[model samples]
Target: MFRAREYKICIIGDSGVGKSCLITYFLTQKFDSNNKVTVGGAYHEKQLFINNEPLHLQIWDTAGQERFRSMTPMYYRNADLIILAYSINSQKSFSNLPGWLLDVQKYHDGDPILSVVGNKSDLEKYRKVETKEGKEYAQSIDATFFEVSAKSGTGISEMFGKIAYQVAETRDRAKQNKTGYINPESQTETNKKGCC
Candidate 1:
């Protein structure tokens, strides 16, 4: 019998970096243009399948405003993946990544999978953070790098799916190490909910 597993994910970044929109788009495949600033945090879930086994992704969209910074480390305590986001059009957002990284390093109990995500790919014309800069930063931090657009729903699937797979395999090394590894591409259910 295949056992079900739950994974925790936390998305953190500066305010107005499109963190909430990314979660909304991933769960619904629709752009949420009316998304407001996340006050403290919002939780969401998606049921996914990996190698035919059930997996539950418990996601948290944390508030990016400076005032909420002190409250964020608690969410980082037990995460399987942490997405550090920045708006491509906002250099300030990108520049603040190290501060966010410091929070994770100082508080995260386990070594979670990290991803540096550049949001607002749809606003490429107004881009302030170059692709090379993002890539180099990700490399320096030893994290996977991706560029996504919540409005256009681009690059979300590949980025999340790949990271989820890596986390799953790592978490179940003994079971999954039996050889003939199958690339279990993600299949998700759109269950609407929130947690904070």
Candidate 2:
């Protein structure tokens, strides 16, 4: 028998950074070069194992256009993990990350478990966001960073795997504390009964 754990992840970034493409590649293991801009939001699900435990991940892909920004906070509120996407070829997209981060902070209380993805890595010839710069920015905010090409299936698995591990770890810690508290209380009750 297998028990499946469910997790919710949200993707955010500027338009044209290929946020939808990354989710497609990870879930379907295939990429569409002609993918269109996401209108409001889309969701995809995939089942995988993290440390031998079954995990069902529901990924929410949000529209990166300016018009959709107002509706984004509702999506962020329930996210267990977040992926901040950027395109290396577009300087504007890269520069807009700070604003995106701020939105996440404001809506999500600045959760620490975030992955910073520099997408469209296949176009490295036209890259403007240097690898060091992306890494530095991620470090400053305590996020894991990766350079990925959703079109080429680069770093897609690794990024999701890291997020899964972080989620699992957080869940495990919570479970341990719950168990520890209950066990001690039961033991105290047994000792009191014996004394009476």
Cα displacement (angstroms), candidate 2, residue 32, comes to 0.7
Clashing pairs in 1: 43-195
Clashes of 1: 1
Model 2 residue 14 distance off true place after TM-score fit, in angstroms: 0.2
Estimate candidate 2's alpha-carbon lDDT, on a 0 to 1 scale.
0.83
Which residues of candidate 2, in runs, are more than 4 Å off? 109-112, 178-196
- lDDT tens string, model 1, 1-196? 7567999999999999999999999899999899988888888999777555678899999999989988888876799899999999999999999999998999998788899999999998999999999999999998999999999999987777777777776666644567645434322232111111
TM-score of 2: 0.87
- What's the TM-score of every candidate structure? 0.86, 0.87
Give Cα distance to truth, residue 167, candidate 2, Å: 1.6
Q: Candidate 2, residues 1-196: lDDT per residue as tens digits?
A: 9579888889999999999999999888899888888878888888877655578888899999999889888887778888889999998998999999889888886454788899999998999999999999999988889999999999888878777767766665566788764334323544333211
For model 2, which pairs clash? none
lDDT of 2 at 49: 76
Name the lDDT of candidate 1.
0.86
